[model samples]
Target: MRILGIDPGYAIVGFGALDYTRNTFTTLQYGAITTKAHTTFEDRLSEIYDDMTQLLAAVKPDAMAIETLFYTTNQKTVIAVAEARGVLLLCARQAGVPVFEYTPLQVKQSVSGYGKATKKQVQEMTRTLLKLPAVPKPDDTADALAMAICHAYSYRSKQYGVALTKRQQMGYF
Candidate 1:
């Protein structure tokens, strides 16, 4: 299975593409789509949409896994992120890619074997799982890769009818 994981944000949207086969992962690509801090919000959205459209075309992932929004104290930031996420979803829909949503807890649990694992812990586990030489930079990039790894585990568990974890046992369907 080819999976693309997305860590959505208006400022820096992180993306990672991976191919999962026989319980192993092959990293295809990982990077961030960054919008300038001073750009107009509308312009930022446009940039995100355009870049994501091109990315979807290039990756052609069988599934797009995205982090679902979590509440934050800053309404402004939350709203902006949500809008960016909307653009991402639309891009996937137009490309005919199947979309899956996962929360931070699910990602952490799947990657690090702990639901409340620290960000550094998850990053390290993701790096280990993918057998990368180093942790991906720009924290969000690592987070995106973790998301991909999480989806890969979930996908395999479903395919093999094995509940590897509590999340898999409950079923993400």
Candidate 2:
């Protein structure tokens, strides 16, 4: 299975692509789609949509794993990120890629075996799991890879016909 993980943002959308097979993960690509700060908000969104459309076509992922929106102190930032996420979802739907949403806690637990793991812990664990020489740069990129790893693990559980508990089902939600 090919999975694309996304860390959505209006300024920079991070993405990582991975191929999972027989319980193994191989990194295919990882990067960010950045929009200039000087650009108009509408233009930034248009850039995101265009870049995401190209990414979806290039990666051709079977599934897209994205972090769900979480409460933040900055309402404007949150709203902007939400809009970016919406564009990502739209692109995935248009590309016929199944989308999976994971909370930050779920992603941490999946990647680091602990829901309360710190950001550095999760990044370190993600690096260890993927056998990367170093943690991916631009924190969002690392987060994106973690999201991909999370989905691979979650999907594997389902692939083997494992029964999910109520809480696990809620994780999918």
Candidate 3:
């Protein structure tokens, strides 16, 4: 299966594409879609939508995994991220890609075997899983890769009854 993972943000939307099969992963691409600060908000959204549309067409993923929005102290930032996330979801649906959402905690647990794993731990694991010599740059890119790993594991857990850690086995579904 080819999975595309997205870390949606108005300033920089991170993405990672991976192909999973028989418990192995092949990293296809990992990068970020950056919008200039000087651009109007509407133009920023347009840039995101256009870039995402082209990316979907190029990658042709079988599924898409995205991080759910987490509440933040800054309402403005939260709302903007939510809007970007909405566009991502819409694009996925329109492109006919199956979309799955996971929280940060779920992603950490799915990839690192602990719900509270540190960001560094998750990034390291993501790098190791992809057999990359180094963690992908621009933290958001690494986060996107971790998201993909989370989805891959989640799918495997369901399809093969693969065992998660005791903590994860409790309420993962």
Worst-scoring 10-residue span by lDDT in model 1:
164-173
Model 1: per-residue Cα lDDT over 98-122, one tens digit each:
9999999999999999999999999
Alpha carbon lDDT at 140, candidate 2 = 90
Two-way lDDT contest, 1 vs 2, winner:
1
Q: List runs of model 3 lying over 4 Å from the truth.
A: 160-173
Itemize residue pairs with steric clashes in candidate 3. Answer: none
Per residue, candidate 3 scores C-alpha lDDT tens digits across 38-91 of 999989998999999999999999999999999979999999999988988888
lDDT of 2 by residue, 1-173 (tens): 89999999999898999998755789999989999999998899999999999999999999999999997899999998998899889999999999999999999989999999999999999899888999998889999999999999888676655776665545433
The global C-alpha lDDT for each of the candidates, from Candidate 1 onward, is 0.92, 0.91, 0.91
Count backbone overlaps in model 2.
Answer: 0
- Candidate 1 stretches with Cα past 4 Å from truth are 159-173
> Any idea what lDDT model 2 has?
0.91
Candidate 3 lands at a TM-score of 0.91
TM agreement with the true structure for every prediction: 0.92, 0.91, 0.91
Global CA lDDT of candidate 3, please? 0.91
